[model samples]
Target: MTASSIEIRRLTAADAAVYRDIRLEALRLSPEAFGSAFETESVQPVGWFAQRLDGGAAILGAFRGGELVGIVGLMVADGPKRQHKGTLVGMYVRQAARRVGAGRRLVDAALDLAAQSVELVQLIVVDGNDPALRLYQSAGFVEYGLERHALKIDGRYYDDILMAKDLVGRA
Candidate 1:
């Protein structure tokens, strides 16, 4: 799968299982990039995923012939001062779909949604995810900061780099 063979759409309750599956895969593949681990999320019940289906956040999914292949999440920052921002998380594309534009499409939808409800969009990427970092940069996201030793996985400390893009106005 490539973007040419895929279609992007907002996720609904019916997609909860697929969402869970993809997210679990992401955590398993890159334990450093995500805050949650497979050991932790595997314990969550289906209702937990179900309850997240429709909420303040916008969940985007990429599908190829009705099979979901990519997903990205958008959630509002909670607080008065930072309420104008949206946090992008749980972003992942299947291995076969990596080189294609599926990931870009997923993020584009998330950014568009963020632009509507928030003025800025932010995300945290693991320091070594160069391909993803480049993609985000190409999409107008800029590295803002880094949380040193932000994540610990497999007994190694890793830094999480924060990146953001201003959507309401310009970059």
Candidate 2:
């Protein structure tokens, strides 16, 4: 994404095509990073995305020249204990979009949106993604704990650190 031309906006049902493209790209290139696979989601019905947006999930897309370059998903739960918390997931920025502030903007959008109904936001990062870890930290996320060998990718186990950020001014 270009420095001055990138736009960060809420993703709508009409942006499902762009969403699918970015999602598939993530799963294909970084299959170990996420819980789902391209083979599984690549064939899913389009209604899946439409229903997702129609529901309560919040999505943000970073677009440059009308092309989606990054995306983040925020899901707010309804339970008493979890109502004040939002979980961050499905965060990805295109390879071409790296180093251009696109990732930070996408994350900032998610964090800002989470502040509406959630007093805190939570996410997990594969320990090896140094840049992402730094970005999350810069955005006020702190490591709380690590899940030992949480993911088994390609016959190897990788640990992930749980991170949380408290939203200030929330009662």
Candidate 3:
């Protein structure tokens, strides 16, 4: 499906079930791309995911024909010194929905939400994910650092590339 047929919107507590399904799918399909483990999140209560949409973080989803097909999250800092920053997280587009602009729309939606209260938005992409790397670059995120052994999955280590985007003009 193409992007034009999908609607981008912020998720709510009512969407917890669908969100949980997609999130777990992402962690299971791409273990190296996220910090959260499917083993841990999959067992969490549905209310846990609902609370995530209630206030703690802003999660955006891409819907096609009323079905949630993609998602991305933005968490704003709460500390005194870090309140002006936000972290981009949990980005995933189902295999069937990829390459039709769902990923880009999700990132753009996250950035749009972050721009409301943050000066900068940051994210960590697992090294060697060229498609994700290119998507971030196209959305104006620039790599700032690299962390070796950022994640260890199945006894294998993977690096992470830290990236950030200044929201000067967008804000």
Q: Could you tell me every candidate's TM-score relative to the true structure?
A: 0.93, 0.93, 0.96
lDDT tens readout by residue for model 2, 11-105: 88888877888889998987767878788999977778777766788888999888999988999988897798899988898998998899898
Off by over 4 Å in 1: none
The Cα local distance difference test for each model comes to 0.87, 0.86, 0.93
Tens digits of per-residue lDDT for model 1, 18-130: 88898888888878878989999888877677778787677889998888888888999888998998999889888878888999988888887787779989999999999
Candidate 2 residue pairs in clash (backbone atoms < 3 Å): none
- For model 1, state the Cα shift of residue 38 in Å: 0.3
Provide the RMSD of all predictions against the true structure, rounded to 1 decimal.
Answer: 1.6, 1.8, 1.1
Q: Write the per-residue lDDT of candidate 3 for residues 29-107, one digit (tens) a residue.
A: 9999999999999999989999988978889999999999999889999999999999999999999998999999899
lDDT of 2: 0.86
> Order of all candidates by lDDT, from best down to worst?
3, 1, 2
| Candidate 2 TM-score versus the reference | 0.93
Stretches > 4 Å off in candidate 2: none
The best candidate by TM-score is 3
Where's the lowest-lDDT run of ten residues in candidate 2? Answer: 45-54
